[model samples]
Target: MGRLTWIGIMVALAAGFSAGAVFGPVLMPRPGAASNPNLIDLSALPDELREKHRNEDFLRNEATNYAHMQEALAQRAAERAARAPLDLPNGMESVPFGLVYKPGGDVHWPEGMTGELGDALEAAKDGWVILNYWASWCGPCVHELPEMGKAAPLYADRGITLIAVNTDPMRKDTPDSARALFASKGIESLAPYVAEGTAVDQMMAAADMTMANVSLPTNIIYAPGGTPYAVFEGGNLSDSPVWTAPQTLAFLDVLAKGE
Candidate 1:
């Protein structure tokens, strides 16, 4: 072969090899292949690129699973709500008293009260207390608060006081913003309680509740004499499929009747 002809052939072969290396996965199937041809072979990528792609896939799957879980919880709450006039049996176990902080900023509390949650509970010792943990950033919590406000008066008539404990931590504008939200939603009846410092951690530990893995609303139901009888975790009937205000009220009604 002439030298020029040999050089040209070698260059052509090199170009073909490069093209095949780049597009081979998509164009050709492996022997006895069961793998998806549409999916990129991440193993062939650089270490950093592979890690990035792996992380993206993990996050996508995580989000999907979370969404599915929320839907399931909402369905469950709906089913429970359909069974109206729910009631809790008597002699239910109770949790011990734990401290919570007073709602800060311009929100008002009774005169001469030191804004200690434990003390407030002690004062209302004879009534059923619904201690709701919420935050402004939490969409489900925001949706449920208005409903809770509407139910507050009726609950109070039945000796149940709905106290919303804001769990937004300490921020310059959090309390003001929370108060504004209450005003905007016309939530007049439910007293605002702030979870500050380590109060949230303490309250969660005391109530045996966990919001670590899931960002769901949690409420603690306390029977007369400050005994925490039940802990409702996850979304409310208003937003989530896990819990409903009606169910809570029914349970309280039974408690009020000493059932």
Candidate 2:
């Protein structure tokens, strides 16, 4: 094969590997999945290419298995909830969420999030969408990230998309840094979304909520059809109404079953 021809083959394989990393881990894509048009004809690739393809498929299957395990664990947690419902702790507001989803409010999507969420939120409109604000400097945010990550697979079960918007870009919070943090913590279920110039104001507007003296590190939940469902303002989950990851898994299970 000519030099350039070999290069083309490698390039195609690289693309497949990267694509596989994204959708493969969660969706558990098969090499011959009918919808995958970009999948190369592996039968023709040299031994090296074939080996890499096999490794990629192995990794993808492993990720899918891990996600399934988390989901099964989540199902068990739901059973526990059925036996004994979770009660709002003292000092926590009785409201299902700090803020209830209001109808027809004008939600100002942050500039970058608009195009992304326009499609994502709409597609997930039939299920659930979770938006969170976080920064590396915030201790609580960092602590909560892993917890949220743990529940992410469960959340994704019913068309859910969890987005954590990074803050303090001016203070040197970049997407890469956030990703590094997540990677360090063994978090694969969610990715850090960069929302430039996003503040409490922008996030509040994005969730179609008015400023109610809430601060950063806000957590907002959306019900099916992209409607604002609830907002759990910042605080330590252990000490506040913000549901812990396990609690949320149970809640989402109950929700998906319409119980």
Q: How do the predictions measure up, each by TM-score?
A: 0.51, 0.49
Poorly placed runs, candidate 1 (over 4 Å):
1-87, 90-119, 169-173, 209-215, 237-248
Ten-residue region with minimum lDDT total, candidate 2: 1-10
lDDT of 1 at 240: 30
lDDT of each: 0.51, 0.53
What is the alpha-carbon lDDT of model 2 when measured against the actual structure? Answer: 0.53
- Residue lDDT tens for model 2, 155-228: 78755677777654234677688889999998887766655544434654674433222234656666666666
Q: Candidate 2: which pairs clash?
A: 125-225
Local accuracy of candidate 1 as per-residue lDDT tens digits, 1-259: 0000001121232232222132222333456778864545556656764554445444355455445545555654464354322123564332111111222122122223235565665577677777776676566677777777877788778887777777543223255677788999888877666655566555545444333322236566666766656544444433432222454456567778877
Model 2, residue 209: distance off in Å is 8.0
Clashing pairs in 1: 73-241, 74-241, 77-241, 237-243
